[model samples]
Target: MSVNSRSDREREHFNALATDLGSVWWGSITKAGQLRLDERAKLAIRYGGLSPGKVVLEPGAGNAEFTKRLATSGATIVGVEISPNQVAIANERLIEFPKAKVVVGDINKLDFPDGTFDAIVGNAVLHHFDLITALPEMLRVLKPGGSFFFTEPNMLNPQIAVEKNIKFIGRALQNSPDETAFFRWQIDSILKRNGFSRIWVKPFDFLHPGVPDSLIPFFQKFSHFLSNIPVIKEIGGSLQIYAQR
Candidate 1:
Protein backbone atom coordinates (compact mmCIF):
# COMPACT_ATOMS: atom_id res chain seq x y z
CA MET A 1 0.00 0.00 0.00
CA SER A 2 1.03 3.56 -0.68
CA VAL A 3 2.00 5.81 2.25
CA ASN A 4 -1.11 8.02 2.01
CA SER A 5 -3.48 5.06 1.93
CA ARG A 6 -1.83 3.61 5.01
CA SER A 7 -2.19 6.95 6.76
CA ASP A 8 -5.88 7.23 5.87
CA ARG A 9 -6.54 3.71 7.11
CA GLU A 10 -4.79 4.51 10.39
CA ARG A 11 -6.91 7.62 10.75
CA GLU A 12 -10.05 5.55 10.35
CA HIS A 13 -8.74 3.12 12.93
CA PHE A 14 -8.44 5.82 15.59
CA ASN A 15 -11.79 7.40 14.75
CA ALA A 16 -13.51 4.05 15.07
CA LEU A 17 -11.91 3.60 18.47
CA ALA A 18 -13.07 7.11 19.42
CA THR A 19 -16.75 6.31 18.74
CA ASP A 20 -16.88 3.84 21.63
CA LEU A 21 -14.32 5.70 23.74
CA GLY A 22 -16.52 6.78 26.66
CA SER A 23 -18.03 3.34 27.11
CA VAL A 24 -14.68 1.57 27.13
CA TRP A 25 -12.29 4.27 28.32
CA TRP A 26 -14.13 6.20 31.03
CA GLY A 27 -16.01 3.24 32.38
CA SER A 28 -12.85 1.25 32.98
CA ILE A 29 -11.01 3.88 35.01
CA THR A 30 -10.70 3.39 38.77
CA LYS A 31 -12.19 5.75 41.34
CA ALA A 32 -8.82 7.35 41.97
CA GLY A 33 -8.39 7.71 38.23
CA GLN A 34 -11.79 9.40 38.06
CA LEU A 35 -10.92 11.86 40.83
CA ARG A 36 -7.67 12.77 39.09
CA LEU A 37 -9.64 13.60 35.96
CA ASP A 38 -11.93 15.88 37.97
CA GLU A 39 -8.97 17.60 39.60
CA ARG A 40 -7.36 18.30 36.22
CA ALA A 41 -10.57 19.86 34.95
CA LYS A 42 -10.83 22.06 38.03
CA LEU A 43 -7.26 23.25 37.62
CA ALA A 44 -7.65 23.83 33.88
CA ILE A 45 -10.87 25.75 34.30
CA ARG A 46 -9.35 28.00 36.95
CA TYR A 47 -6.24 28.68 34.89
CA GLY A 48 -8.29 29.21 31.73
CA GLY A 49 -9.99 32.15 33.51
CA LEU A 50 -13.48 30.74 33.24
CA SER A 51 -16.11 32.49 35.37
CA PRO A 52 -19.85 32.55 35.72
CA GLY A 53 -21.56 33.49 32.43
CA LYS A 54 -18.26 33.35 30.50
CA VAL A 55 -18.23 31.37 27.26
CA VAL A 56 -15.74 28.54 26.89
CA LEU A 57 -15.09 26.19 23.98
CA GLU A 58 -13.94 22.62 24.52
CA PRO A 59 -12.73 20.67 21.49
CA GLY A 60 -12.62 16.89 21.29
CA ALA A 61 -15.15 16.78 24.12
CA GLY A 62 -15.78 13.05 24.33
CA ASN A 63 -18.74 12.31 26.61
CA ALA A 64 -18.44 15.85 28.02
CA GLU A 65 -17.02 14.52 31.25
CA PHE A 66 -14.60 17.39 31.58
CA THR A 67 -17.14 19.80 30.16
CA LYS A 68 -19.67 18.80 32.78
CA ARG A 69 -17.13 19.45 35.51
CA LEU A 70 -16.33 22.85 34.05
CA ALA A 71 -20.04 23.65 34.07
CA THR A 72 -19.99 23.23 37.84
CA SER A 73 -18.04 26.48 37.86
CA GLY A 74 -21.19 28.12 36.45
CA ALA A 75 -19.63 28.96 33.11
CA THR A 76 -21.28 28.54 29.73
CA ILE A 77 -19.51 25.78 27.79
CA VAL A 78 -19.76 24.60 24.19
CA GLY A 79 -18.27 21.17 23.62
CA VAL A 80 -17.31 20.68 19.99
CA GLU A 81 -16.68 17.15 18.80
CA ILE A 82 -16.15 15.52 15.42
CA SER A 83 -17.99 12.28 16.15
CA PRO A 84 -21.74 12.49 16.15
CA ASN A 85 -21.63 9.45 18.41
CA GLN A 86 -19.66 11.27 21.09
CA VAL A 87 -21.72 14.40 20.59
CA ALA A 88 -24.88 12.51 21.36
CA ILE A 89 -23.26 10.95 24.41
CA ALA A 90 -22.00 14.33 25.60
CA ASN A 91 -25.43 15.88 25.10
CA GLU A 92 -26.99 13.09 27.10
CA ARG A 93 -24.41 13.31 29.85
CA LEU A 94 -24.79 17.07 30.08
CA ILE A 95 -28.58 17.18 29.80
CA GLU A 96 -29.07 18.38 33.35
CA PHE A 97 -26.56 21.21 32.96
CA PRO A 98 -28.40 23.82 30.92
CA LYS A 99 -25.23 25.90 30.68
CA ALA A 100 -23.36 23.25 28.71
CA LYS A 101 -24.04 22.10 25.12
CA VAL A 102 -22.28 19.74 22.73
CA VAL A 103 -22.16 20.42 19.02
CA VAL A 104 -20.79 18.32 16.17
CA GLY A 105 -17.83 20.13 14.59
CA ASP A 106 -14.17 19.79 13.73
CA ILE A 107 -11.66 21.75 15.79
CA ASN A 108 -9.64 22.69 12.72
CA LYS A 109 -12.75 24.07 11.05
CA LEU A 110 -14.56 25.74 13.94
CA ASP A 111 -17.65 27.56 12.62
CA PHE A 112 -17.76 30.20 15.33
CA PRO A 113 -16.83 33.83 14.67
CA ASP A 114 -13.40 35.18 15.48
CA GLY A 115 -12.80 36.35 19.06
CA THR A 116 -16.06 34.83 20.14
CA PHE A 117 -14.89 32.67 23.02
CA ASP A 118 -13.69 33.69 26.45
CA ALA A 119 -11.55 30.56 26.71
CA ILE A 120 -10.82 27.19 25.11
CA VAL A 121 -10.19 23.97 27.03
CA GLY A 122 -9.92 20.22 26.59
CA ASN A 123 -8.64 17.08 28.30
CA ALA A 124 -6.42 14.45 26.71
CA VAL A 125 -7.27 15.93 23.32
CA LEU A 126 -4.41 18.24 22.41
CA HIS A 127 -2.09 15.46 21.27
CA HIS A 128 -4.69 14.14 18.83
CA PHE A 129 -4.29 17.37 16.82
CA ASP A 130 -1.54 18.97 14.77
CA LEU A 131 -0.60 21.99 16.86
CA ILE A 132 0.68 23.86 13.83
CA THR A 133 -2.80 23.95 12.30
CA ALA A 134 -4.99 23.75 15.41
CA LEU A 135 -3.34 26.34 17.65
CA PRO A 136 -3.71 29.16 15.14
CA GLU A 137 -7.39 28.37 14.70
CA MET A 138 -7.81 28.25 18.48
CA LEU A 139 -6.13 31.63 18.78
CA ARG A 140 -8.35 33.13 16.09
CA VAL A 141 -11.56 32.13 17.77
CA LEU A 142 -10.43 33.17 21.26
CA LYS A 143 -11.10 36.72 22.37
CA PRO A 144 -8.14 38.85 23.33
CA GLY A 145 -7.20 38.11 26.93
CA GLY A 146 -8.84 34.70 26.69
CA SER A 147 -6.87 31.67 27.80
CA PHE A 148 -6.27 28.15 26.48
CA PHE A 149 -5.89 25.34 28.95
CA PHE A 150 -5.75 21.56 28.71
CA THR A 151 -4.12 18.41 30.03
CA GLU A 152 -2.13 16.03 27.83
CA PRO A 153 -0.02 12.96 28.41
CA ASN A 154 3.53 13.79 29.40
CA MET A 155 5.74 12.13 26.79
CA LEU A 156 8.52 11.86 29.35
CA ASN A 157 6.64 9.40 31.56
CA PRO A 158 8.25 5.96 31.48
CA GLN A 159 5.02 4.03 31.04
CA ILE A 160 3.75 6.50 28.46
CA ALA A 161 7.10 6.25 26.65
CA VAL A 162 6.75 2.48 26.53
CA GLU A 163 3.18 2.63 25.28
CA LYS A 164 3.91 5.16 22.52
CA ASN A 165 7.19 3.69 21.33
CA ILE A 166 6.07 0.06 21.36
CA LYS A 167 4.02 -0.91 18.34
CA PHE A 168 1.74 -3.63 19.74
CA ILE A 169 1.09 -1.88 23.06
CA GLY A 170 0.49 1.49 21.43
CA ARG A 171 -2.04 -0.01 19.03
CA ALA A 172 -3.72 -1.91 21.85
CA LEU A 173 -4.03 1.38 23.76
CA GLN A 174 -5.66 2.91 20.66
CA ASN A 175 -2.80 5.30 20.09
CA SER A 176 -2.69 5.85 16.35
CA PRO A 177 0.53 6.73 14.54
CA ASP A 178 -0.78 10.29 14.20
CA GLU A 179 -1.18 10.77 17.96
CA THR A 180 1.65 12.05 20.18
CA ALA A 181 2.33 12.87 23.82
CA PHE A 182 3.70 16.33 24.55
CA PHE A 183 6.86 17.52 26.24
CA ARG A 184 6.79 20.79 28.19
CA TRP A 185 9.34 22.49 25.94
CA GLN A 186 7.37 21.54 22.86
CA ILE A 187 4.13 22.97 24.28
CA ASP A 188 5.92 26.15 25.38
CA SER A 189 7.44 26.67 21.92
CA ILE A 190 4.14 26.05 20.11
CA LEU A 191 2.20 28.50 22.29
CA LYS A 192 4.87 31.17 21.90
CA ARG A 193 4.98 30.70 18.15
CA ASN A 194 1.21 31.01 17.99
CA GLY A 195 1.28 34.49 19.62
CA PHE A 196 0.25 33.30 23.06
CA SER A 197 1.70 34.74 26.25
CA ARG A 198 1.94 33.90 29.92
CA ILE A 199 2.29 30.22 29.13
CA TRP A 200 2.30 27.86 32.14
CA VAL A 201 3.22 24.19 31.88
CA LYS A 202 2.88 22.05 35.00
CA PRO A 203 3.37 18.32 35.27
CA PHE A 204 1.15 16.38 37.71
CA ASP A 205 -0.66 13.03 38.24
CA PHE A 206 0.74 10.05 40.21
CA LEU A 207 -2.01 7.46 40.51
CA HIS A 208 -1.58 4.58 38.09
CA PRO A 209 -4.14 2.22 36.56
CA GLY A 210 -3.00 -0.71 38.70
CA VAL A 211 -2.86 1.04 42.06
CA PRO A 212 -5.39 -0.22 44.61
CA ASP A 213 -8.17 2.15 45.69
CA SER A 214 -7.07 2.30 49.33
CA LEU A 215 -3.51 3.25 48.39
CA ILE A 216 -4.60 6.04 46.06
CA PRO A 217 -4.37 8.81 48.66
CA PHE A 218 -0.90 7.69 49.65
CA PHE A 219 0.17 7.50 46.02
CA GLN A 220 -1.43 10.84 45.23
CA LYS A 221 0.61 12.54 47.95
CA PHE A 222 3.80 10.86 46.84
CA SER A 223 3.09 11.76 43.24
CA HIS A 224 2.53 15.45 43.93
CA PHE A 225 5.71 15.48 45.98
CA LEU A 226 7.68 13.97 43.13
CA SER A 227 6.24 16.40 40.58
CA ASN A 228 7.72 19.26 42.58
CA ILE A 229 11.32 18.09 42.36
CA PRO A 230 13.32 19.26 39.37
CA VAL A 231 13.81 16.74 36.52
CA ILE A 232 11.86 14.09 38.46
CA LYS A 233 8.56 15.87 37.74
CA GLU A 234 9.05 15.37 34.01
CA ILE A 235 8.05 11.76 34.38
CA GLY A 236 4.69 12.55 35.93
CA GLY A 237 1.56 11.35 34.13
CA SER A 238 0.13 14.53 32.62
CA LEU A 239 1.14 18.05 31.60
CA GLN A 240 -1.31 20.84 32.20
CA ILE A 241 -0.77 23.86 29.92
CA TYR A 242 -2.30 27.30 30.30
CA ALA A 243 -1.66 30.15 27.89
CA GLN A 244 -3.25 33.52 27.18
CA ARG A 245 -4.20 34.29 23.57
Candidate 2:
Protein backbone atom coordinates (compact mmCIF):
# COMPACT_ATOMS: atom_id res chain seq x y z
CA MET A 1 0.00 0.00 0.00
CA SER A 2 1.04 3.59 -0.63
CA VAL A 3 2.05 5.80 2.30
CA ASN A 4 -1.00 8.00 1.79
CA SER A 5 -3.44 5.10 1.91
CA ARG A 6 -1.65 3.53 4.83
CA SER A 7 -1.75 6.82 6.74
CA ASP A 8 -5.47 7.16 6.04
CA ARG A 9 -6.16 3.68 7.34
CA GLU A 10 -4.06 4.39 10.41
CA ARG A 11 -6.05 7.54 11.09
CA GLU A 12 -9.27 5.56 10.89
CA HIS A 13 -7.89 2.91 13.19
CA PHE A 14 -6.79 5.53 15.70
CA ASN A 15 -10.18 7.21 15.54
CA ALA A 16 -11.95 3.94 16.23
CA LEU A 17 -9.62 3.20 19.10
CA ALA A 18 -10.13 6.65 20.57
CA THR A 19 -13.90 6.38 20.30
CA ASP A 20 -13.86 3.00 21.98
CA LEU A 21 -11.86 4.40 24.86
CA GLY A 22 -14.09 7.46 25.09
CA SER A 23 -17.14 5.26 25.50
CA VAL A 24 -15.50 3.54 28.44
CA TRP A 25 -14.19 6.19 30.87
CA TRP A 26 -12.36 8.19 28.22
CA GLY A 27 -9.17 6.17 28.47
CA SER A 28 -9.00 5.56 32.21
CA ILE A 29 -8.72 1.81 31.65
CA THR A 30 -6.34 2.32 28.76
CA LYS A 31 -4.27 4.58 30.97
CA ALA A 32 -4.03 1.78 33.50
CA GLY A 33 -2.53 -0.41 30.79
CA GLN A 34 0.16 2.26 30.42
CA LEU A 35 1.44 2.27 34.02
CA ARG A 36 4.50 0.17 33.29
CA LEU A 37 5.15 2.07 30.06
CA ASP A 38 4.81 5.43 31.78
CA GLU A 39 7.43 4.52 34.35
CA ARG A 40 9.92 4.02 31.53
CA ALA A 41 8.83 7.23 29.82
CA LYS A 42 9.16 9.23 33.03
CA LEU A 43 12.60 7.81 33.62
CA ALA A 44 13.65 9.00 30.17
CA ILE A 45 12.21 12.45 30.81
CA ARG A 46 14.06 12.70 34.08
CA TYR A 47 17.28 11.60 32.44
CA GLY A 48 16.70 14.19 29.71
CA GLY A 49 16.58 16.96 32.30
CA LEU A 50 12.99 18.03 31.73
CA SER A 51 12.28 20.97 34.02
CA PRO A 52 9.24 22.40 35.71
CA GLY A 53 7.75 25.58 34.20
CA LYS A 54 9.12 24.80 30.75
CA VAL A 55 6.90 24.74 27.69
CA VAL A 56 6.75 21.20 26.30
CA LEU A 57 5.26 19.89 23.09
CA GLU A 58 4.32 16.24 22.73
CA PRO A 59 3.97 15.16 19.13
CA GLY A 60 1.70 12.14 18.67
CA ALA A 61 0.39 12.32 22.19
CA GLY A 62 -1.73 9.20 21.72
CA ASN A 63 -4.02 8.96 24.75
CA ALA A 64 -2.40 12.03 26.35
CA GLU A 65 -1.66 10.10 29.51
CA PHE A 66 1.96 11.21 29.46
CA THR A 67 0.94 14.76 28.66
CA LYS A 68 -1.27 14.76 31.75
CA ARG A 69 1.67 13.65 33.85
CA LEU A 70 3.84 16.42 32.43
CA ALA A 71 1.14 18.98 33.16
CA THR A 72 1.08 17.92 36.80
CA SER A 73 4.72 18.93 37.00
CA GLY A 74 3.68 22.59 36.45
CA ALA A 75 4.94 22.64 32.90
CA THR A 76 2.97 24.17 30.05
CA ILE A 77 1.98 21.22 27.85
CA VAL A 78 0.88 21.26 24.21
CA GLY A 79 -0.02 17.98 22.54
CA VAL A 80 -0.34 17.43 18.82
CA GLU A 81 -2.33 14.35 17.80
CA ILE A 82 -2.99 13.01 14.30
CA SER A 83 -6.46 11.71 15.06
CA PRO A 84 -9.26 14.23 15.62
CA ASN A 85 -11.10 11.84 17.94
CA GLN A 86 -7.96 11.42 19.96
CA VAL A 87 -7.46 15.17 20.21
CA ALA A 88 -11.01 15.60 21.49
CA ILE A 89 -10.65 12.77 23.98
CA ALA A 90 -7.27 14.08 25.16
CA ASN A 91 -8.71 17.53 25.64
CA GLU A 92 -11.57 16.13 27.70
CA ARG A 93 -9.27 13.91 29.70
CA LEU A 94 -6.97 16.80 30.46
CA ILE A 95 -9.64 19.46 30.97
CA GLU A 96 -8.86 19.90 34.62
CA PHE A 97 -5.27 20.74 33.77
CA PRO A 98 -4.88 24.50 33.43
CA LYS A 99 -1.56 24.18 31.64
CA ALA A 100 -2.53 21.74 28.93
CA LYS A 101 -3.81 22.01 25.34
CA VAL A 102 -4.31 19.60 22.43
CA VAL A 103 -4.24 20.12 18.68
CA VAL A 104 -5.36 17.79 15.90
CA GLY A 105 -2.52 17.64 13.37
CA ASP A 106 0.36 15.70 11.87
CA ILE A 107 3.85 15.99 13.32
CA ASN A 108 5.44 15.90 9.85
CA LYS A 109 3.71 19.20 9.11
CA LEU A 110 3.42 20.56 12.58
CA ASP A 111 1.51 23.87 12.64
CA PHE A 112 3.47 25.36 15.52
CA PRO A 113 5.88 28.24 15.01
CA ASP A 114 9.63 27.79 15.23
CA GLY A 115 11.20 28.03 18.69
CA THR A 116 7.75 27.64 20.25
CA PHE A 117 8.67 25.15 22.89
CA ASP A 118 11.48 24.43 25.35
CA ALA A 119 11.27 20.68 24.89
CA ILE A 120 9.65 18.17 22.51
CA VAL A 121 8.77 14.67 23.70
CA GLY A 122 7.16 11.69 22.02
CA ASN A 123 6.89 7.98 22.80
CA ALA A 124 6.21 5.20 20.33
CA VAL A 125 5.28 7.75 17.65
CA LEU A 126 8.11 8.36 15.20
CA HIS A 127 8.29 4.88 13.63
CA HIS A 128 4.76 5.44 12.31
CA PHE A 129 6.00 8.06 9.85
CA ASP A 130 8.53 8.11 7.03
CA LEU A 131 11.45 9.15 9.23
CA ILE A 132 13.12 11.26 6.54
CA THR A 133 10.24 13.73 6.72
CA ALA A 134 9.34 13.38 10.37
CA LEU A 135 12.77 13.90 11.96
CA PRO A 136 13.40 17.23 10.23
CA GLU A 137 9.97 18.48 11.22
CA MET A 138 10.61 17.59 14.85
CA LEU A 139 13.82 19.62 14.82
CA ARG A 140 12.15 22.57 13.09
CA VAL A 141 9.70 23.15 15.91
CA LEU A 142 12.33 23.01 18.62
CA LYS A 143 14.14 26.06 19.96
CA PRO A 144 17.89 26.27 20.11
CA GLY A 145 19.05 24.38 23.23
CA GLY A 146 15.67 22.68 23.48
CA SER A 147 15.61 19.03 24.42
CA PHE A 148 14.09 16.23 22.33
CA PHE A 149 13.03 13.00 23.97
CA PHE A 150 11.79 9.96 22.09
CA THR A 151 11.35 6.25 22.69
CA GLU A 152 10.88 3.62 19.99
CA PRO A 153 10.87 -0.15 19.59
CA ASN A 154 14.45 -1.25 19.07
CA MET A 155 14.53 -3.50 16.00
CA LEU A 156 18.22 -4.20 16.59
CA ASN A 157 17.34 -6.26 19.61
CA PRO A 158 16.91 -9.97 18.90
CA GLN A 159 13.89 -10.46 21.14
CA ILE A 160 12.22 -7.32 19.84
CA ALA A 161 12.74 -8.39 16.25
CA VAL A 162 11.26 -11.82 16.91
CA GLU A 163 8.18 -10.44 18.67
CA LYS A 164 7.68 -7.71 16.05
CA ASN A 165 8.08 -10.11 13.13
CA ILE A 166 5.39 -12.32 14.59
CA LYS A 167 3.03 -9.36 14.74
CA PHE A 168 4.05 -8.14 11.29
CA ILE A 169 3.49 -11.51 9.70
CA GLY A 170 0.07 -11.82 11.33
CA ARG A 171 -0.90 -8.35 10.11
CA ALA A 172 0.41 -9.06 6.60
CA LEU A 173 -1.64 -12.26 6.42
CA GLN A 174 -4.71 -10.11 7.14
CA ASN A 175 -3.66 -7.69 4.37
CA SER A 176 -2.64 -5.04 6.90
CA PRO A 177 0.74 -3.38 7.10
CA ASP A 178 2.70 -2.81 10.30
CA GLU A 179 5.48 -0.24 9.99
CA THR A 180 7.35 -0.70 13.25
CA ALA A 181 10.94 -1.41 12.36
CA PHE A 182 13.85 0.82 13.34
CA PHE A 183 17.19 1.73 11.78
CA ARG A 184 19.30 2.74 14.76
CA TRP A 185 22.20 4.21 12.81
CA GLN A 186 19.90 6.13 10.47
CA ILE A 187 18.04 7.65 13.41
CA ASP A 188 21.29 8.79 15.04
CA SER A 189 22.52 10.29 11.75
CA ILE A 190 19.24 12.13 11.27
CA LEU A 191 19.49 13.70 14.71
CA LYS A 192 23.05 14.78 13.99
CA ARG A 193 22.08 16.28 10.63
CA ASN A 194 19.33 18.27 12.31
CA GLY A 195 21.94 20.08 14.49
CA PHE A 196 21.04 18.37 17.73
CA SER A 197 23.95 17.85 20.10
CA ARG A 198 24.49 16.07 23.41
CA ILE A 199 22.81 13.01 21.96
CA TRP A 200 22.29 10.11 24.36
CA VAL A 201 20.72 6.75 23.63
CA LYS A 202 19.66 4.28 26.31
CA PRO A 203 18.06 0.88 26.02
CA PHE A 204 14.99 -0.19 27.98
CA ASP A 205 12.33 -2.88 28.51
CA PHE A 206 14.69 -5.84 28.23
CA LEU A 207 12.19 -8.22 29.83
CA HIS A 208 8.85 -6.87 28.69
CA PRO A 209 7.36 -9.11 26.01
CA GLY A 210 8.15 -12.46 27.61
CA VAL A 211 7.30 -11.55 31.17
CA PRO A 212 3.90 -11.69 32.89
CA ASP A 213 2.25 -8.47 34.11
CA SER A 214 2.41 -9.44 37.76
CA LEU A 215 6.20 -9.67 37.48
CA ILE A 216 6.65 -6.38 35.58
CA PRO A 217 8.06 -4.44 38.52
CA PHE A 218 10.67 -7.07 39.21
CA PHE A 219 11.39 -7.44 35.53
CA GLN A 220 11.67 -3.70 35.13
CA LYS A 221 14.32 -3.62 37.85
CA PHE A 222 16.20 -6.42 36.10
CA SER A 223 15.80 -4.63 32.78
CA HIS A 224 17.28 -1.47 34.27
CA PHE A 225 20.19 -3.46 35.58
CA LEU A 226 20.78 -5.10 32.21
CA SER A 227 20.55 -1.73 30.44
CA ASN A 228 23.22 -0.30 32.72
CA ILE A 229 25.58 -3.16 31.87
CA PRO A 230 28.06 -2.25 29.11
CA VAL A 231 27.76 -5.04 26.57
CA ILE A 232 23.97 -5.60 26.81
CA LYS A 233 22.71 -1.99 26.87
CA GLU A 234 22.52 -1.66 23.12
CA ILE A 235 20.45 -4.82 22.65
CA GLY A 236 17.27 -4.14 24.64
CA GLY A 237 13.67 -4.08 23.39
CA SER A 238 13.35 -0.29 23.24
CA LEU A 239 15.63 2.70 22.73
CA GLN A 240 15.18 6.02 24.46
CA ILE A 241 17.04 8.98 23.02
CA TYR A 242 17.64 12.48 24.34
CA ALA A 243 19.24 15.29 22.39
CA GLN A 244 19.63 19.05 22.58
CA ARG A 245 18.98 21.35 19.64
Candidates' C-alpha lDDT:
0.80, 0.70
Tens digits of per-residue lDDT for model 2 on 1-245?
Answer: 55567567657767876775552122124333366457655764675456677888888786676677767667788888778887887888898997888888876678878888888886666766766667777788888988888887788888557656787653432212445656567667778886788887766657654355678678768877987898677787778877888
Question: What are the C-alpha RMSDs, in order, of all predicted structures?
Answer: 2.8, 3.7
Model 2 Cα RMSD, Å? 3.7
Cα error of candidate 1 at position 156, Å: 1.0
- The weakest ten consecutive residues by lDDT in model 1 span 1-10
Q: Identify the runs in model 1 with alpha carbons over 4 angstroms from their true place.
A: 1-15, 18-28
Give me the runs in candidate 2 sitting further than 4 Å from their true place.
1-3, 20-33, 163-178, 207-213
TM-score, cand. 1: 0.90
Per-residue lDDT over 85-189 for candidate 1, one digit per residue giving the tens place of the 0 to 100 score:
666777888989999998987676689999999999988888877666778889999999998999889989988888877878887776766677888898899
> Which candidate tops lDDT?
1
User: How does model 1 fare in lDDT?
Assistant: 0.80
Q: Provide TM-scores for the models.
A: 0.90, 0.83
Best prediction by TM-score? 1
